[model samples]
Target chain A: MVLKHIRNLKNRFSSIVSRIFRKKRDIRIGLYGPVNSGKTTLANRICMDWLGEEMGSASVVPHETREIQTKEKVQIKSNGKSLTFNLVDTPGIATKIDFEDFLKFGLKKTEAKSRAKEATRGVIEAIKWLDRMDMVLVVLDSTKDPINQVNITILGNLDARNIPLLIVSNKADVRKSSTTKIRNAFPGYDVIGISAKTGQNMKDLYGSLLKKL
Target chain B: MNLKIKFIPYEKMKMDSFSDILRDVKENTIILIDAKLKPEEESEIIEKTMESVSEKFSGIELSSIDFAGEEEMNNFERFKNIIIERIIGKKRGMTIIGPAKIIHKIKKNPKELLLYM
Candidate 1:
């Protein structure tokens, strides 16, 4: 128990030191979440809104993003305030990956196995990059239940690292989506409901980003 | 197939460096911890699981339920639980971790964890 507190203190100290040193470096805002939670869609929306280009492809299939994709020099202005930062789109994090699951999506056996392997690597990469993020936007599907181990672990790690984050309750355009449920699940955090597909409530997101960073 | 369930105290988990836990998990054992693992510990376990992932061993299904906020506790009970947790440096909860192959899913509710095989 003492060791746990010591580890937490060490994490806080390292977070502070990193923040102090990162002032001169490029700010990296990462999009992270569970599998198929619309992270890449949000990343693409942000890029298209500000840079007039898309960052990455969004797909119905999970783990479409098998590597970390970054778009540099994204500048957004909202309410007369502008901020420029690098947007990093990370592959979805999952605890288990089975090739048979991909087969259910109509993928060939070989392709499914290959994708599963790459996804495992991608999960490792995303975890490793958690320490490098200046801030994170935890994208979650508002239509699904928010109380899960993956969400808890992600939020917990961010809290331990002292990294600023905003819980993005995405898929707000869906009829069954409920941001209130998400807020209830994770209290005491900034949560915004948005639809990347329809460009809904993006201005508020930008304003929040400008204010937070 | 026979199933093995190991009950491990939080202190022994820390002392054993989680190596034993991981090995038992790979050998098809379900692990039940007396306390909810810290977030850092969970992340460390995930990292280790990824490193150990193979064609035979995929990963784990993990879920935890803490008494705080899960049930309607009186203010006094809540306060006592908080104080006890603060003094012990461990949350009053339980964690169940099993190999993903054996445990297909572990659905978490506010008060209980439903394991699917």
Candidate 2:
């Protein structure tokens, strides 16, 4: 049972108040998406740009960050614009976490099992933390299909909670990157194309993030 | 329609009876249900699926209508295969039962109730 915390409710209330008053300071902005979609990469980019440091390490293996990592008070100054908020880089959300999937990547049985367990817990923790977020950056891999079960479920959860969101189409540097498909998959929502690794179109992302706030 | 079956251990379950878990199951949906008995005992499932049977699932009280239909009464051989192939004689396991599309729909809805065998 991944129930919402009372602390989340209080934070949401204050966040609603902050948005109405146009106050961006200390706002909880979460990065949510599927595994290996470059959420940690994007988080690191933002942190590196403003704070001169990275929040956590990224891995080629799936579910590298199984716990929520936060970099607070990241004051972004870009394109002659600025906004200050807490960057909550969360674990990737997966509908299914099979140890066998990890085993295919050459992990030992025991290590695979423990990683699966931790990833499962991380998913639940991510959902519980959603209530505390005033806004979310729904990062998606532009090279993959956007209509996947994980993406739909993430969007559904965010919609059910009525949270404000901006879809960050990550990995646009890849040859097959297509933000149009993502826009079609989720119409009426703002989608921005950016290469978190190469820093392509990052200025547009900054402008969009400010609009979402 | 393709289907998948998985096993769930009742020892760690919070429910006392199969009906307790059955109450949260939605109608006309493909689902994994416990099917460990011999094919002959397919009759036993009849008792669990009776329209009049009611029980608690995860604390919410409901009835069998929430899970199955009389149509299931005719699928003994299918259930038998699920038992032999998936359960492999394990005293406890689950069988996927329903239209492939509905089952996929259930799987996609992350908020849907799942004993998730």
Instruction: State which candidate has the highest DockQ.
Output: 1
Residue B112's lDDT in candidate 1: 88
lDDT values, one for every candidate:
0.89, 0.65
TM-score of chain A of each: 0.92, 0.87
What TM-score would candidate 1 get against the native? 0.90
Question: Please, what are the lDDT tens digits per residue for candidate 2 over residues A1-213?
Answer: 112234446756865775676453468899999889999999999999888999999988898899999888989866677888999999987544556668888999899877876776677677667767778999999998786545755765677568899999999999999999998877778899999999999988988888776
Q: Candidate 1 lDDT, tens digit per residue, B17-48? A: 66678899989999999998888888778867
Please list all clashing residue pairs in model 1, or write none if there are none.
Answer: none
- Give per-model TM-scores: 0.90, 0.62
lDDT of 2 at B10: 29
Please report the candidate that would top TM-score against the real structure.
1
